[model samples]
Target: MKHKEYRRVVTGHNAEGTAIIESDQMASQMLERPNRPGVRLTNFWLTDQTPAEYDGPTETCTGDFILHPPQHGSVFRCVEFMPEDPEVMARLSSEDGANAFAEMGAGANIVQGGRHPWMHRTDSVDYGIVMNGEIWMLMDNEEDDVLLKAGDVVVQRGTNHAWANRGTEPCTIMFVLIDGVTQAGGGKGIPPR
Candidate 1:
């Protein structure tokens, strides 16, 4: 899939307390995993704390683009998912999935024996907005996949899930992942299914 570069315009207050454009440029922090071919992540911005403070013109996502958000923060990114390839899916292994997640600093998020190799869980509340094309949101149950289209919004709480694009074009979804604690009380882990 050919990824599209999005323009990011950031605004901030100047020394005199007037609003101004901090930075306006194309977002170039695109991450593509070799193991997960055709999947691309374009990170726009990130905040490292809740009630996010405005520290005036700072680059927050200068480091590696990890899957989970910062400890007490949130991440804003757009993920592009290409149409699924049966051969590629068949070739995927648990070790491959583990390696991919490990590279994203979420080794423990991978679901070992789930329905799909890409099925994983995160300890965050994610707001996913389908921007283009369509995708199927697969959960733990095999019979309950939800089909999402452009303009659709899904509030994905911490759950074991994966995305599958079955259409001809690539599916683009903007995601805002915020650090969350499960109601079950564990702090960091998948909630009970």
Candidate 2:
């Protein structure tokens, strides 16, 4: 899959900014390598990762994600996001018990590590896939972290946890941030924040 040639559709929209784009044919035949110039979100850079006291805990889960948008000419997108830079995130990632963080607003890589904190909501739902590589999810009083690779889907409900990229190269993952907070178990039946 060269330049937008694969098949994956991932976009973002919110109060801060609004952007919608896919590896559609329009993008496939007209996209730059390493840097999708004309396309938006060519870069997902985060500015911080700080911990807070509004979060219950994160669960340990792993998986892969191969994206394919609506257009046939669209390209494929893949990448895993393992809390690879835990050391750095340890200082930046949220830990104040907040609901969750919105790295998308900063275009920042949640795995790169930073002072990013949680968003503090009633229920925070994140749905995505493990494009590549593997991640070690850390949880409280949990057995062992879960291992996920390519073509795997993962969901994080109620809990306090982060990620650990135990793989070689960089792992990519796409996520959809749902509003709400943990209710019964961790983030179980919790309502949106």
Candidate 3:
């Protein structure tokens, strides 16, 4: 599989309190899907909180990074999905594929029991920008599935949803997930933190 490289440049303060480039390098982590051929994920950056200042070089993140939603003040990452052919879709719809996907989701600690095969909900607001190709965003309720093309953006709240690529080309999406809390009484209120 061809891997994608993400070059990251980080800035920090110098001794005289002047901003300078702290580090610049290509990201090293590239996660591949076992069940779904051609699917890959590259986590470019992550922060535990809304950082007050640039401390130093970003920490190297290991292991599965997408198991759960971002915590309070946290931000997740960007992932790319390769378009699935009919064979791949059939495999994904089979029992073995379902089990494999479930295991993968478990490793990421995603919430289980979505209506679709990979349906799950997160307690965060996700900003998704389609960088290439076309894909469908499947929701859990009455809203029609949204077909997103390159350059389209979707603001995803805390909702149960899944992504489907019915085209013949790969789709890349950049996502920044911000932590949020669902208001009490199910009124769609995210109260001030």
Candidate 4:
């Protein structure tokens, strides 16, 4: 899928401590993996620690685009989800899902026998907003699903879930993920600090 281009404006302080526009341009880091066809992720920014430092690197989205955020930080990005092909979906197996997660640097997070092959867990509190089109959010429950349209918002705690774009057009969602601690001490991605 062709990911949507978003104009990102970053603000910072100049030499004299005056506010300035650090960067104002279209985000160019669109990640589209063959393992997860019809899905594209565009990372905007990443913070490695709380009370984020303002005098850090201009571009913090370096390195691999893993599914999880930094150990004690946050990640902001947008995802484009195209309608799934039933034929392709039916042919996929549990190992295929694990392999896909592995491609994203999170093989252990994949749910082997979940409701959907793309079902996976993340150790972050995600704030997701449906920016365009519509999609369905599937949880651990097989029968329970939520349909989200433009302007809808979902606060997803560290949980096992998957997204499905049942609509004909592609769905665009912006997500802000903050590292969190789970009841079982910590998750595989983000450890308790």
Winner by TM-score = 1
Q: How close is candidate 1 to the true structure, as a TM-score?
A: 0.93
Number of the candidate with higher TM-score, 2 or 3: 3
Q: Rate the local accuracy (lDDT) of all candidates.
A: 0.87, 0.36, 0.66, 0.86
Cα lDDT tens digits, model 3, 1-193, are 2546788777778889998887788877666767656667666666656552347445535556454444655444667777656665653433443454555453232335444455656667889899988988987663778899999999988776778788887788888777777767675743433
Give TM per candidate. Answer: 0.93, 0.40, 0.79, 0.91
Candidate 2's C-alpha runs over 4 A off are 1-122, 142-144, 181-193
Show model 3 residue runs off by greater than 4 Å. Answer: 51-53, 60-64, 93-115, 141-143, 189-193
State residue 91's C-alpha deviation in candidate 1, in Å. 1.4
For model 3, what is the alpha-carbon lDDT of residue 115?
Answer: 41
lDDT of 1 by residue, 27-82 (tens): 98888989888899989989888789886345677888799999799999999999
What would the per-residue lDDT of candidate 4 be over residues 30-86, giving only the tens digit for each residue? Answer: 688787889989999999999888787778887888888898999999999999998
Q: Of the candidates numbered 1 and 4, which has the greater TM-score value?
A: 1
RMSD versus native structure for model 4: 2.9
Q: Give the higher-TM-score candidate: 3 or 4.
A: 4
Candidate number with the higher lDDT (1 or 2): 1
